[model samples]
Target chain A: MIGGRLGIIVSGSLTKGVEVRLDSAISVEDIAVGRYVTIEGEKRRFFGMITDVTLDAIDQRVMATPPDVSDPFIAEVLAGTTTFGRLHVLPVLTIGGDALSLLEGPQPVKTVPVHFSVVREASEQDVEQVFGQVEEKQFYIGTPLDMETKVRLNPAELVKRSNGIFGKSGTGKTFLARLILIGILQEGAAVNLVFDMHNEYGWKGSSEDRREVKGLKQLFPSKVAVFALDEESARRRKVSTDFVVEIGYDEIEPEDIAMLRETLGLTDAAVQATYRLARRFGERKWLESFLAIEGREELNELASSLGEHEATMAALRRRLDSLRRLRFLVPHARDNAIQRILDYLDRGINVVLEFGRYTDYTAYILVANLLTRRIHAQYRERMERALGEDIAKPRPLVITIEEAHKFLNPDISGQTIFGTIAREMRKYNVTLLVIDQRPSGIDEEVMSQLGTKITCLLDNERDIESVLTGVSGKSELKAVLAKLDTKQQALIFGHAVPTPVVVKTREYGSPQSYKELGFREALELKKKAEEEAKDLWG
Target chain B: MPAKIGEVIEASSGEFTAQCYELHQPPSFGSLVKTREGEVEIYGVVSGAATTSIEPGRRPIARGREEAEEEDIYRSSPQLSKLLRTDFNALIVGHKEGQKLHHYLPPRPAKIHSFVYLCDAEEVEKFSQSFDFLSILVGAGGQADELIAASLRHAAAAHQDPRDFLIKAGKELAVLLGGETNRLNNILRRIKV
Candidate 1:
């Protein structure tokens, strides 16, 4: 640390955290929320994050002016606004060594930093000590807003549990989500499947001004497979396609349609009619045969022959016919589309299912729920089998879903497959990187399951309340949350990070940022995977 | 150069009292005055001044208006200046030992009857370079802000660069006053130009 005194410790009875005032060189207002400051302790150097900065008048004269002044301006000028600042910093990590190095990782504050110690801005070296050495396991998401030091998260922790990225619209939520996926890919810690509703993740996506950003497929071509519901849309955007996933009528289960009940605006009678049709024609072939009946002529023929209510069948057909326009559904041309996804995951290749221009909530929800449900069930079975066998468990999988509230809202959470994965995916090594504008819409149970959350600015009261979780020091954290810049800044805290830090997300799409984020390391792994593919073929 | 005003009659670490030797009336309140103590010189601002007989606990007898004036009785007595003594109380600002000046009270106060000099232009000009003395003056007992402002005007005029001296004093007061910008601004408004 610098030898100069930043401030003196005002309290000697400090037990939990130390209060150190800044020296005259700086003021309290100058220190921003979430800025990292260091205090010199008796035995070790303690690193603290500024949670609050308050201004106070030190003398009564500073607050009041003598009333006898005839000139108002003079009276105004004479009234003292001389204020002292009080910085509420929380000590997070403590280091013990003559020479502080990242290699000597800091431990959680076992002993609070010494009182009366000078507090200074946490230098790049001090910040790196808390985050520790940057290795394959550590993924640098961004640098802290106040310091130039990089803030990295443990990817191993990310894959072991579910996490979330939340922010209001235009707060760079998607950009942050893309960065996290890149981090997950660089580490090869998990096979991520991004359900791109707006077709933004797999192919080139431009920002508001059409600033073209390279998609995940473009970055790692062989490692990521771009699966689009409509091949034409993907081709129009020049997104190289690996597979065309189509959900055939025969493959649509009762649960798949049940997931869409609220979205399709279907009545309870309509859902029961579909079930009745399934029971009569057998569950496997019922959806295919039902789609075969196109008009009222066929509907009337099936109703009379099958001995069912004519109005109920007609309502069911109307709802089913309305959904036929969706490209994912086809009448028995091939087998299950989910098998293809399992094939990609089994091969350790990530899959990004682009919805093409299908950015609608209902379609995105239906497709994501159908595929994730089948795949997550398969994973649950595989995990159970792995427990009994000697073979290693399958590689961890993280599914990135956008508009997460549509599936996880309390209204649908009880039946939505996405909700199931959110609450119980950890045991199956299948976690979610759910992204949304309204985190408050998600069920409280699923919110609690989120192991780590990287949230940008959220103004909605409920959204802020939901994102804050039940962490201690919530009021202080809320203050920090309220001050987050609307662009490129995030507060990361929870299981994946040792402490909460506000980071200015590194520039995405910049070649230099890509290199700094370890894109080369991932490319090397891609080459190795190609080699292994060749050896297997030979 | 201003004339020598009086001699120090009593002294302490923070303040001293002086008896007028030649002047008809004591230096006006908040006047910049000085006295010598050994090799070093001590500085102070007059907090108060009074006229009384050399004899203790005495009050002058006032009769009706004399001559054509309504309040000229005291002036009519020509020997009053000789019979009575005038003294001023000065709050110690600092003392200069050698070439370096300290902005605090001196270790030793002025001696009895040490000749007190009305500060010359050079003396005031050199001391005005540091506004530290203003803190002591403002912190003194009565009407401190006004006294400090008055002292600044006198000192600023003594300095070669009066405008710059006043500006520097204003800056120092801005910090010392904390957020009391009105007081500092008023002082600056009064002292500027």
Candidate 2:
């Protein structure tokens, strides 16, 4: 048999059953926790350190590795072989290294260089297995920061500040954000509003797809109202006029006017002048009363004197006119939806205003900002009432903003309402879960404020660097984030987790079947339906 | 009785029938035959009545030895002769491999056939008639000569009757020419020709 200095000698013949000790020849410095070595011609790898090494008292020449071995064969083998020879015979392997050299002498030995190998192969079982922790109170940003290791977070620490989820398309930003929301809602927290920009999150479940349906309803019930501003819905509702009226001059604050001026590239003086005009018109409700102002000449004359920025004033007036004409801004009816959402939130019910098909980025930004600001205001009022004396008992409100880069970018100037909420929401227990494709694309300030960051497979280098800059424990987390594979596989860092972990996202309520129908199936179904219709008609 | 010069006769069998249209005398003359909806030319050194009767509407056939030797000449000519008239300079120049012919000739059309009508004599002189004759050249003088040689060769071959060979050859030639003709007809129809 091939024999060498025993790098490690165990009490038992079988590798796994007994305690092992390294040969004195192998220097303590050279032996690593995960290093491998050859022992008695059998290849063996060791996890952790060699705990004990000593000579056998009964047999003067033999060294006893550790623990008492009663087996006669093992005892005889141990008596005959030197500790170095026994330990060295088996090969030591490293994760990315060549097998360790057989121990030649009793002197301390060095570990072999690692040869790269496919040591960890993910199997179908890995994909099918659901691995996560159910925690009390705060969201369990499941698993360790390393995608390979399982680690859980301390839930109590997570809810203190709002979270942010940001990544590029197909990076599992939406799925992870939904998981966090589900975690929080499942813990019996008051219902919070989800300003779903993509309309991907809040889906109603059907009887056949009961799991997904129940999961969605548990998160967002009928109490959660949906307002679709799509062309078809707008036309059908016939409330476009009221929508405009509801977006009254009051909706545009002085700061908002300043922002509008900046966005429109107008002067400060012009902005102040327009603000004054708007304030006066708003106080008198001239926008609402203008329709009753019988004389068109009088209305035109009144609109002209607004300011030197007559163009902006005219646009706003036209917007008002269009709203009235189309009956789109039906404030009373739309307000009912808004109020219902707020009422659900007040009753501790979660509300999701899913924006499924709104393509106009400008409109989405405007509406989401308005809703966030309104929700922040309500939350602040509730916090003040509940913890007037004890600021510590702050009612935590997790506000998950999907596609956050559109509204939360810090570069955009003027009082961005979303930015204001982001900055001040922390004091009122308003946490922001900012979800996007690339974390780098989100406002740097907003990213820095996110205490808990659950990062998934980030293909872009810049996005990975952005997440690294935001999180504190980069060593393990960076390695984990580098290797993320699927939608729910994420390296969760920040206050929510005790240590960074790689966790498979837990299923909340109903499983979402965003799996689109294939083209051929859809076509076949359409043809079949047409045939059936023809048959029925005949 | 021995066959007279230029006299057409039927070559018939239980399964086949052919007509010979005589072209020359000396028992070495070639003749064209129409049988079973196909036409072929054949040549032979001997002629006599066959055992079977000729089918109605089928014409008589003839074949002679000189026609057979001429066929060997047609088969040996290069492909270029089939694309252009024998008089064309390209036939002479292209016959030499690696010799450029572009300067003297227009680009060759995509599809070439033997029976295509040629009004240009320059094309006929430069290209060998065998190579230059397209499937479209059925009624052309060059095709008539080639047919005469082909029929004579068929007559000289023992296993297949000359008349039968001519009929089959005609049908095959028709099929080969049919594709190009249909394509040309389509082009003409598109142009409202």
Candidate 3:
């Protein structure tokens, strides 16, 4: 059994963790890093992870002139007596044996286990006691290493603040994000507004193996709406989208253009010129009027009258002209896209805005920023009014964005609506689920503001460091994070979990997995059970 | 029952010397032997044995050159048997009082002229059940590795699984001589089944 006694605590401290001398029968090679272990102290049971394994000898001379261990008798005798395996264990949480602690559950360990305490491999029940079983608010994300016990992530606490899902390219960030979104939807924690960059979260998404998997809309048609920016592209893919969305020129604000300065390659003067143009023309008419001044003589005259450089105005015009090529941008939109999204969110239905063919940074940044700013303003107004009038506050809304560094990077994070939501939007019932491949590019403040972070294998040193910044036992977690398997494995920690845990992510792309994820088959199974019950009763 | 092998001629708390009753005969070296002082039974391992002239100043000359065989000389000189006595030295490893066996020195030494007996297989098995006496044997001075190896080999023969017994004893020696890898290797090489 996995609960067999592993070893005893030989030496350690509260901060540096403890060292365990393994039993002779347990070979050092059998002990793996990141495996869960529990120490049975006199007063408490401490749970920890194996961070390092080392071969130790009782005598230094034995190493220099090694005994002839080719003989089984000699090897067996020397194994535990003269040589043994040592494990470096970081005790993270303590499940106190006292009655008060039993009621309180696992708490962060403030003291180390006593010397020579018995340490053993953590059993399934012990893990369940710590992470808990799948409950209403707790979502089963995955299983820990060499264990079947589910590691449940608390979606209720997760939605209370912004979160980030990070990994290198092709590390299944989208798949993980989709699972978390499904968790939020399933538990009714909050309504999600996903800015689907590559149409990955709406109707269908292709896995790494190229198999088409059902997206959120196909699974929960009534509770999900897929809005497409390019309807022709959506039609080509045969995705039955809920609505086609467009952005009018008048809807663009000076701040929106200012946030897009990097993506549009606008200089400082050009970025500032947006504010000047908004002042010259009305805030609602600035973009349309700026585009209307086509001739060079009229542009120069307008620039002179506005006390702006002609060259700067020309550069700003040239950069702004690129937005004209985007098919979704028009002088006037058929229906207000922001109102449609807010209405769907207010009705407790999630909305996924599919970029369709416009998956570039320019288009993604422009559309996501413009739509979110207005929606956030609406939420802020409603929240302020709710506080003043004491009416029921708006339902919490989580806005999901990909390539978050583009908006939350240090240079533009102060002005982007996504950055504002990440920093202090929890009071307004709005949080951001930022997905990015390069977490290092994101601002430090935003990264630290994240409530919980679930990341896959990232070998970059800076990325790993940034993800583990401000975390206690950072070095131990770094070792665990660096050794993660590249596929379907993740390390989750922060506000939602009591301790950092490495998990083999749950299955996501099969008929069986779909049923487990609560697809239509689950409803059919429920109905069948109900019918059987009715027959038995009647 | 144990075989009566000798009589304690020299006695001390840590060790005792016994002279065999028969000529040129002594229990095998490193064999388990026990002697008594009143009610306490003191256990010892036969560290060494020798057959020499009983007198301290005299030496014996070889008369076997002209004899047809070595036995003829001893037969011709009947006094030679009395002249040369086989004496063995046993290091006190443990003692037994009442029903409990202790792996430590007794409060008193073996009495002079006390009978010494070679322990039987059952007694050897009972004594070898705990390896605590091993520390005493390891620190018993000269040729300790060889003495430990011989005693363990003799004790193994008393168990059902000789190899398991030797391995268990070998582990004890390994811990006792943790810093002396060469000595441990020598003992292991000798004791391994």
Compared with the true structure, all predictions reach lDDT values of 0.77, 0.42, 0.90
| Candidate scoring better on lDDT of 1 and 3 | 3
Q: Which portions of model 1 show Cα errors greater than 4 Å?
A: A1-31, A39-46, A50-119, A133-138, A294-310, A333-336, A514-538, B1-6, B10-15, B20-45, B48-87, B92-111, B114-143, B150-193
Q: Give stretches of model 2 more than 4 Å off.
A: A1-156, A205-215, A218-274, A283-304, A310-328, A331-338, A389-395, A412-414, A473-483, A507-538, B1-193
Residue-level lDDT tens digits of model 2 in A1-538? 0122333334432232223444433333443221122222223222111222233232222232331236432222223222222221212121211233223212122332132211121222221122233433334444322233334343335556756665556666666666566556545443556766654455442231233333233343433334444435435433121121134333534444344332344466645654565566664343355434445465456556654344544454444343343233442333544455566566666666544345445445655665666667776777787776654443466666766766665565125656666666467777766777767766777666678787777767777887778443343344446666655566665665433445666533333322110122334566889999999998
Q: What is the TM-score of each predicted model, taking all chains together? A: 0.77, 0.44, 0.94
Give me the displacement of residue A125 in model 3, in angstroms.
Answer: 1.4
Candidates 1 and 2: which is better by DockQ? Answer: 1
Which residue pairs of candidate 3 clash? Answer: none
Q: How much is the lDDT of residue B146 in candidate 2?
A: 43
Docking class of 1: incorrect
Q: Model 3, A1-538: lDDT tens per residue?
A: 4888999999998888899999877898888888899999999999999988889998998898888889988999888788889999999999858665699999999899899999999999989989987763356889999899999987789999999999999988998998898888777899999999999999989887888998997777678999999999999999998889989998988888888788888998998889999998988899999998879999999899989999999999999999998999998999999999999999999999999999889999999999999899999999999999999899999999999999999888988888899999598999999999999999998999999999998889999999988888888888888888878888899999888898888888898777667576447766888999999998
Worst 10 residues of 1 chain B by lDDT: B62-71
Error of 2 at B115 (Å): 99
Give the Å error, residue A204, model 3. 2.1
lDDT digits (tens) for residues B1-193 of candidate 2: 2232222222222111222222121222222111111222111112112221133354433333445675554455434223322111011111111322121212221121111121122321233222222232333233333443433342324322434433333333323334333332222222110
Looking at model 3, what is the TM-score of chain A? 0.94
Q: Give the per-residue lDDT digits (tens) of candidate 1, residues A1-538.
A: 2323456566522233456665544555466888887778766777777787665554566457433337543333322234356677777777655344335567666556555777777878777767765764457887886566777777777878888899899898888888888788877889999999888778677654568887787676667899888888888888788888888677677777877787787777777777878888888899878877778888888888767678878877777777778876777647557888999989989999999877776678778988888899899899999998967888899999998888889988888877888888588889999998999999999988899999999888889899887865566678888889998889888888878889998888777765666556567887899999999998
